[model samples]
Target: MEQELFTAQDLEELQRRGISLEEATQQVEDIRQGFPYLEILASASLEDGIISNEPSQEERYMSLWERYLERKDASVYKMVPASGAASRMFKMLFSFLDADYSEPRTEAERRFFDELHHFAFYELLNEACLRNHWKSIPKLLAQGDYKAVVETLLLPKGLGYGSKPKGLLLFHRYDKVERTALEEHFVEGALYARDSLGQVHLHFTISPEHQRDFESLVARVKDCYEEHYSVRYLVSFSQQEPATDTLALTPEGGLFRREDGSLLFRPGGHGSLIRNLNALDADIVFIKNIDNVVLDLYKGPTVMYKKYLGGVLVAIRDQVFGYLRQLDKGKVSHSQLEEMSAFMRDAFGIRLPEVLDDESLAPWLREKLNRPIRVCGMVRNEGEPGGGPFVIRETDGSSSLQILESSQINMADEGQRQFFEAGQYFNPVDLVCSLRDWQGKPFDLERYVNPKTAFIAHKSQVGRELLALERPGLWNGAMHDWNTAFVEVPLETFNPVKEVNDLLRPEHQA
Candidate 1:
């Protein structure tokens, strides 16, 4: 298929949108290179598809448990990408810092800052302001030193938000808590005993601007864990530039940008973490977001589910490796060979298994039947956060488990409507995959990756008034391959502090 060449008009439009001609040209080149698969994806259909409702076979679960028992010594690596700006959180802090102290700040602002000061954010400020010995905010502000006051009071000691990194946000839920988000992640690693077995390592990816803060956060976390958990830190940080187009106007109504022409915005979807995950040298890696940590009370069930998922992967790996071995030895029949190849595609593409009633042609040698994938819940929960699991047809006329973002669904279609209505959905929390089997063959991420669809985000400025806007996200325009799965964890495990009101909830502040 011929690649679509970017027209001069398109380039001009990008430049008008603040993308330089040089960068625009590079983006065009990248798109051209990644476009062929998208064309193939565009031609596919998911009509008359039925979601898989079958339960996992008892034997399969037992086999998974068995593998978990045997490989109790195997290590697990956790990677949290923490290089985001706390601009959103700090914007609220700025409201406190810039308040009319003589008249008194609003109750809402006072309460938030009270919690912020009680939480580790204040200690971070104390450390930063040590030279000035800021006994009082009035004293610091009296000197007409707004930057120093901000640096001392608001900024974490070594890191500046946007100027530093998001992971270093002085993230304590309460005054008594000394852990930041970075520390919390390490704490989980320690709880999992990741460092002890050398089986689990915690790695953080940060931008170059925040490298020192990243190191400092690592050191602090190491110190805390060593004294408390007897766990050494396996923490490491990788430096990468934040995506350039992720900027937006601050709530105070001014544009925020990094030194690199990039907008200070949310990490461009966790999908961007794929490249970094691929670059890691670990045998087994668990990819998760920075803010997804549950409080210590909820950690047990969450970790159990994580282990269950990993156990399943270990069992599946053995089966796949056995089949591969047979294929390599030429010991498989023609029918078996075809079946093995089909499984390889389905496993990697994460495609939904074929339904028996579907009109699609059935292969002669089906090694395994379809089963439902889920994060088994011990309790009913609130609404699911991440994309749901769906059976989606790919460009190659095959189907797999696709994490369904509502943006990916064309709501105009009736089939999609029914499909959406019928299935149980779960958030993509921590996932499990085995590094090696009894025979010691490595697990291939490419084997489980869906390579069909990629995204082309539309950058636009939409608003209700004359204010300028920037919206760059993977919503409707983000094209993802269909093999996705959603497994619901417990409600206690999902506490996201999206707004100041959210912190007031006992689950977060408590």
Candidate 2:
């Protein structure tokens, strides 16, 4: 039956992409059956799951993080997930290009032209305008030719920003020059992730087709940042491997084909970066989005919060390791086991099933305490369009704190819907992770993922609709089994440039 579904050429392509037959079959089945909604027990709030540390606790954590950095063997790195094009950021401008009348009709369109000179890329766009149309932006605007300027900014004939990644686009302006989002990361790494050895490390996950452009940009700017900051920069990049791509399927489990009659596959979302992250050789890894950056003038709060999260992770990690070492020696007293369970509750919001008595608790505690640790920085929810923290019911009848996307919930259920809506904080993709085990050896990062949490997206190829399975999100389910903690970070620390006009927000303005 499987042979009848996949032709010889289909099998050959699958082989080339490192996908096993069973894996492909399972993906089809998962897509057909659809993922089950996570059983959310309650929303995470300050009274239960989220942690709001006092100033004294914040200071102690920051100091502990500094001491950890001072260790001679420390290897800290920042991971920025920066793949895909920036076309979404230019959606409004793209519409303007095809509009019947082109004098900034929409509010967003008006804002773009009204604040044209305020954009960091204004000078560059003007230069492109002269080269492309032999007319400056003001000259063209004087003639009521707004489409000309929009064309020059997005089309290949101009700056071609509509096709480029956000990392390479100019994001902020300064006294000396403008900086791309990638350059801002270089500046940020120097501020917080730099080690005592004066080396700042960063890793970017980029698309293979844009690898050369990103490398060239890095080559041209790396030396200047090194000179300015007086710190050496170590950077690396990786593309999502073909093995991580999932096959698209119809709701009935039939394969979806492209216009040319070949099977269609899509990259399995950012969760697939777990493999790239597992390959990294850092003791401490900071995960952040590529567009969530600000100018140097607004970086103090961000720097302070990053250090605080790191300190929190290291402190908890040390205690976890110590308790695991004790459990390893065996003969743990009943009181010691109870203390461990209580600490687990206080530290991670983990609650074991009451049915497990002293005998069962030892092994359970060992299994729970020995996993990886991640400290997630969350901000107060202010009507953002993303997931929030929740205490979800795990398969084993225990409860764990997880950052859940709306798609993972059964929104139709009134109880779950209310719990989700009641959430007061939002995850900002700010994280500090410890990937090593108690003995300093790297854990098998793949073993911790909750494969049942994958998301099936509705997409189109050649105007035909199909469902594409995205692996569990990196922070959402990819790290589901890791010991997770949440810290309330200042909203000032999150300044993501989702749309072109968003850059005009005060957070993005220096």
Candidate 3:
């Protein structure tokens, strides 16, 4: 059967649902043009399972200690995507402009401002406002409604900041020596890798507009690492043009339409980066938020855990490759097949072994034992951030381990509530994979991705208060059918700088 294309009626229906005629027409055109690459990506699969359990708890600890004694070497890669604007931080600037020193702010207002000042960009704002001589600490409350002033003097040129990328926001404690979030993350990556793994590859994904700043930051990182181990930097950007108007949908189940009649949808989420990641083609990839990095004093345990995690992944990949080669030679015997299937079901955490309904394997790995693949987390001191690990039973009667995202768990469910309270385990910044096999066959991403699960994000708008946006994240939305496993790493490995105050912590200051 052929797939149906959008028809004239579809356009009419879209317009009735709130899309402008122009946007409806454009959507129709885009549908006709088709996204071939996306379609291909949506169709790939990973049938062969990943390697099953390897070292036990005792064995792993002993192995790591032994490896440390031998000075085992590993490479570290850190990817920081610095493309988002600092829109949230703008709220503080507004508060500053609207302050009134004469009457004094109420406790509530003062508390809010203090919290806002904690952002990483606060210092940058202070410096920019100071440089422009925009009234040294003007009495915000006494100022006659600075709304107009803000619009006219600030927003038009990127809020009085450099008007460059938000990643370029400067933080200088003394003299001219300054640092941006970009520099901080790069240094963190370099330090962690050097102290733990002995070598590191730090890459930043930036937009074309910020190329110069990105290059400058790279140079600074190189200089800092000159006395330490080797460090390499790779920079790349999406060729797609930036959107002018923010895409949004209307409240009446209608697409937000412009006077020009263009239909609107929120910019597709970060999962769009999966294509960019595929492009990197590195042997190993470490994905971390641009703002998340540990400072010097706290670098030891974090680097150690990163290497251990990477080492485990490398070892698993080696085992998977070896198994695939065995499977390629003639028909796998019943005993061998049973062992492989058992490993997949028990250790790799695969859930759909019976999907093929091969009678030959039914007697071995039972259906009820099948579960969704997941990475088990073991968190050490410092604890873990983000979501904790939990057993997830899919609708298909199989269950696997998964990381928690506030949006995914049903708050109303008693079982989910219990799991949440129990605090099963922390993610510990480690992952499982079947990306490549022993025979070097690329694991098909489409086959493993769970199309049914997703999360919707609520975003704040300039005029419109809040809007919902849907996008896929790596943990819940990015994984596939390949059996997965989880291992624990030290909690010190996950130092993340979510706010500016975080830089004041002993780790970052070092």
TM-score of each: 0.63, 0.99, 0.67
TM-score of 3: 0.67
Ranking by lDDT: 2, 1, 3
Instruction: Give Cα-based local distance difference scores for all models.
Output: 0.47, 0.91, 0.47
Stretches off by above 4 angstroms in model 3 are: 1-77, 89-130, 134-167, 170-178, 188-200, 207-212, 219-228, 239-248, 330-342, 351-386, 426-434, 444-447, 457-469, 480-483
| Full candidate order by TM-score, most accurate first | 2, 3, 1
| Cα deviation of 248, candidate 2, in Å | 0.6
Candidate 2 per-residue lDDT, tens place, 420-476, comes to 989999999999999999899999899999999998999887777889999999999
310-375: candidate 1 lDDT, tens digit per residue: 555555555665764564455456576556546645453333345432222223122222121222
Which stretches in model 1 have alpha-carbon errors above 4 Å?
1-75, 90-164, 173-177, 193-199, 241-270, 331-386, 417-424, 434-452, 458-486
Task: Give the per-residue Cα lDDT of candidate 1 at 78.
Answer: 79
Superposed on all Cα atoms, model 2 deviates from the true structure by an RMSD in Å of 1.0
Global fold similarity of model 2 (TM-score): 0.99
